[model samples]
Structures are given as C-alpha cells and as structure tokens.
Target chain A: MIASGYLISVIAAMGIVTFALRALPFVAARWLQRHALVQALGQFLPLAIMTLLLVHSATGAALAHAGWPWPELLAVALVVVLQWTRRNALLSIVLGTCLYVLMRNFLV
Target chain B: MNDSNDPAHGPQRLSVLSLSAPVAMGYVPLGIVFGFLFVQAGASWWLAVLASLLVYAGAAQYMMIPMLAAGLSVGTIALATLIVNSRHVFYGLSLLDALPRRRLLRWYIVFALTDETYSVLTTIAATTSDRQKLLVALLNHCWWVLGTLIGALIGAQAQVALAGLDFVLAALFAVLTVEQWRTKKSAAPLWFALGAYALAYGVAAKHALLLSIVLSLVAGMLWQAKSAASGEVQR
Candidate 1:
C-alpha cells in the first residue's frame, strides 16, 4: 500500500511538470508570435541561450582552473572543431565524450 | 554563406516525417547515462523506464530519480524538475513563433522541446520548409523516447556507471555551443551567459541560478536591439 502510494505520487508529479512545460509554450507562443519585440527576441535568443547553455552545461568535472584538466579542455576543443567543421551533432558528442572518458582514465 | 541563398531568417513550413535516425543517434548514449543514474539512485528499472517515457526531461528526470528514491515528496521532485528545466521556457519563446498552428503539431512541438532538438531545428533558417522542421521535431522526440526506454531496459544486462554520466549534459551543451558559433551572426549567448553569471553571482547573493538565465535572456534581447540600431546608424 505504501509503495503504491509512492508510485502514484511520483507519476503524478512527473506528469505535472512535463505537462506544464509543454503547455505553457503553446499558450505563450501563440499570443507572443505577432509582436515585433517578441519576434526580435526570438531571433537573437537562440544565440544567447545557446552560449549560456554551453557554459551552463560544462559546469561539471573541471572549473575556472587552467592546466588542471588539460585533457577535458582538449576534448572540448575537439568538440568545437567537429561542430565548426562538420556541423555534426551526434558525431561531436560521441567523439567528445569518448575522448573525455579515455583521457580521464588514461591521461589523468 | 551566399547572401541570396542564406537559409537563416528564411520562411519555413511544418516539416513532414521525423528525423528519428539523427535524433536517436544523439539520444541513445545520453539516455544510457540517465538509466545508469536511475539505477544508481536505487530505483528499479520500472520506475525509471516509466518516468523516462512519460516525464522525458533528461536532466530533471535524472535529478528526480535520486530525490524520489530518497522518499522525497512529489512536490519536491516537481519543484526541482521545474528549476532544472526553467530554461525550456526561453527555448519555447523563439521556436514557438514558427510552430504550426494546427492541433497535433502544437502538442508535439511543446512536448519535443528538448535542448538538442531546439538547437538543430532553430538553426535551419526560419524559412526552411515547415514540413521538414515538423518531421525533424517528431523524429527528435522519438529518438529521445526510444533512447530512454532502451537504456532503462538495459539496466540489468550489465553494470552501469553513474559517475561520469553527469557530463553528458555538458557534452550536449558543448555541441550546441559549436552549433551557435558556426551558423549565427551573433555572439550574444556567450556574452550573455558570462555577463549574466557575473550579475547573478553578484546580485543573487543566495537566489536560484534560474534568475540569471531569465535576466540574461531579457538583457540579451535589449542588447541585440541596441547593437542593431548602432549598426544601422554607422552604416
């Protein structure tokens, strides 16, 4: 009985967050789509958000230190190279991840 | 790169068909990490699989597993999920403009707003055929769903490591970073994040980091307008 209660709660909680995030955009976007300012923001938001996200995402492993995690930095450099040269998403992720794992274990 | 053939700022239609293969390629390994962590959190495969299928927010789902396993309240999990995924709100702001006004696509677009999908779909110049973009979005959702399901199912097959799995999100972000740098004409994201992080750290004192993301988005928009105006004046 207790376990089932927990299960129900988890599912319900998950449902709400998932549903809310999905629904908010539809409502917000429809109303905001025709606005000049909103459209302009949308245009530039991608570049800004992507940059913030990159910095946001890389908050793992190493920090604002230099030479401490040269391997990780080098792997990131490779990811940048792959992204720039080929624009291949999956390939860069795979290569960057593999390089990091190998470097973390072997080099470090 | 040609001015006449520029794909950016192009008129687009809802893309037909799904880009499942590409989406899958991106999601599988990443989802494996989510599954591995779910197991590490002491949750059974059933719980993790169901959440991955239904909830489907990669970062938060992973975060939820540990909290849920710890017997935390549903509200707690939900709140954490909201915080981790608050950025999704901003992601929707831009892409929603091009979204199909129809019923089904709207629902799917909202549901499929994963970071990877948003990054890929948003860059195809606004004018890319909407049919293609819709297909790409649908395919991207399938890839993530399938990846999560497969990863959770594979839980018992072998030992799964959670230690390094956290890095997948970072890696995915790195991929997005490269994407933005290559195609876009602006460096706003990089500068926004740095400036926002600094501002957030300075003013927040003890507030959530999410405030920074929101403020940064607003500041970024304002900064873009100012820069464009300056360029026009200089020209």
Candidate 2:
C-alpha cells in the first residue's frame, strides 16, 4: 500500500495548486485582462498541455507492458474518435477502457 | 426570460436541479472510476474521497493516480497539477461578475469551479439567484464525492486485480484532449506538443513530462510573438 502520510501530503499540495490556479484570475482579473501575453498563453496552453498529458500517460502505459503498443494505440484512438463524434466523455472513457481491459486480459 | 408566471421557490429549485442534472450524469461515473482506479493503485479508499472533496478537478485527480503510484515527489505532482489545471485560471476570468458577492458564497463557488460547474453557471439563466447557483455547485460536488465513496467501497471489496484497468486515466485524458482539440482555432498546439514530447523523451525519458511542458511554454510564448508580429505586418 502507498504510504498514507506521503499520500496526504500529495493531496494537500495538489489541492493548494488547483485552488490557486482556479482563483488566480478572480484575484487578478485586471492584471490578467491587461496582459496580452496572458491571453496568448491562455489560448496556447490548454490544448497543448492536455495533448501532452494524453501522450505522456499513454506512453507511460505502453512502456509498462511488453510487446507492441497496439492495445494502447487502439484504445486511445477509439476514445478520441468517440469523444469527437458523440461529445460524451463518460461514454468514450468507459468504452475505451473496457476495450483495453478486455484486450489486456484475453487478447494479449 | 420570463419568470412572471413561475412559482417562486419550487421552480427555482427545480431549475437548479435541472441545471446540475447533466453535470451529475458525467461526474458520478467519472468520479467512481477515479476512486476505483485510485484504490486499485493501492491507496486507501478514503483518500480518494478526500481527493474528490478537496482537489475537485477531475483531470488532475485522475493524473495523480500514476504519479502517486510511482511515488513521485509532492513538488513534481504539484507542478503537474498546476500545469493540468492552469486552464482554470481562464475559467474564472469569464466568471468574475457572475459569482455571488457575499464572501462565503463567492469563495465557495470559486473553490467548487470544475469545468462542468463553470459551464452550468455560465449557461444558467442570468436571473438565477445566488443561492440557486450555490446549490448547483453544491449538488455537483456532492455527486462527485458520493460517487467516489461508492466506488472506493466497491474497490475495497474487490481483491482480484485486473490488468489495464488503469488505462482509464489515458482514456480520460484522451477524451479531454479531444474536447480541447474540438474548440481549438488551430491544430498547431497538438503538433507542437507531440514534437516537444518526442524531444524531451530523447533528452531524458524520466523527466520527459516536465521538460516537455517547459518546452511547450517557451514555444507558446514564441508562437504568440510570431502571430502578434504577423498581425502588425498585416496592418
């Protein structure tokens, strides 16, 4: 089991970081609005960060197991396509994950 | 926007429920998955509930599972959380005026601002009362925590380990990335991110995520400068 003390600390740190990010614009609305760079980063960062997270996590998962990353690639692609077409997050995640679990258990 | 024929408290309560109902649909199952995966990662169940209660951001909470499993430093996880949640900074910009004025209510609403909550608040009738808005946030929050509790309990009961179940995290990120892509003005960020990740991986596989994020930040600034200069030239 993961150490509870360490886990608590991580949770606390994450909570602080998330709250700070959410609260920043409210606390500094004027400053944020005046800065063109802020707007630029705002427009530029979200998609990039999300894409990186997806790629990084998928790569991490792919590396953890042996053999080709077909399962990883297929599942992620299925999720992306489902999300893009249906616009339903829960459906995409559930179906993609279910497909992945099935592949890892039976197919491989 | 006519509320003239509407009854006072009942209809308002119904509307709040209706506004939050869709959010509940998404949060409950997603929260359950987060809690279950987190527990399956070997942390205690209550911590998952605590995360859902406190961190409240779905993607960051999901992202934390593997980091915690790998025993990443709090600093690294915190940095990752900051990067993952930075979009929330922009979320509050559009909500500055709409939030309740009372300090307690306003701050609570601010604290509870998930993507779904933000969308619901933004789309709700402008005439929505501050209290009803609070209810929407509160109800959504409850759904998330409740789902976490349920899933954690279920996870605790299940002893058989299933391979690849943790891939839910990737699927969640994929879904989020696709949504972000849909709203994107240009696909340059996607390509830029992939390129940065590839370079970062080559430089240091262990620190790839952090290095890539730093690279992406630098690239974002340069991209913005280039676009701004181009606009000037066009003028």
Instruction: Point to the candidate with the largest TM-score.
Output: 2
Instruction: Name the weakest run of 10 consecutive residues (lDDT summed) in model 1 chain A.
Output: A57-66
CAPRI docking class of candidate 2? high
* lDDT tens digits, residue span B93-207, model 2: 9888899899999988999999999999999877788989999999999999998998888889997768888888889889888888888899899999999999999999998
Evaluating just chain A, the predictions reach TM-scores of 0.62, 0.92
The weakest ten consecutive residues by lDDT in model 2 chain B span B1-10
* Winner by lDDT: 2
Cα lDDT tens digits for candidate 1, B64-131:
65456668787767765664565576677677667777878767767777777777767666766666
Off by over 4 Å in 1: A1-30, A40-50, A63-67, B1-19, B57-110, B113-142, B156-165, B198-211, B214-218, B224-235
Report fnat in order of the candidates. Answer: 0.45, 0.88
TM-score of each: 0.65, 0.95
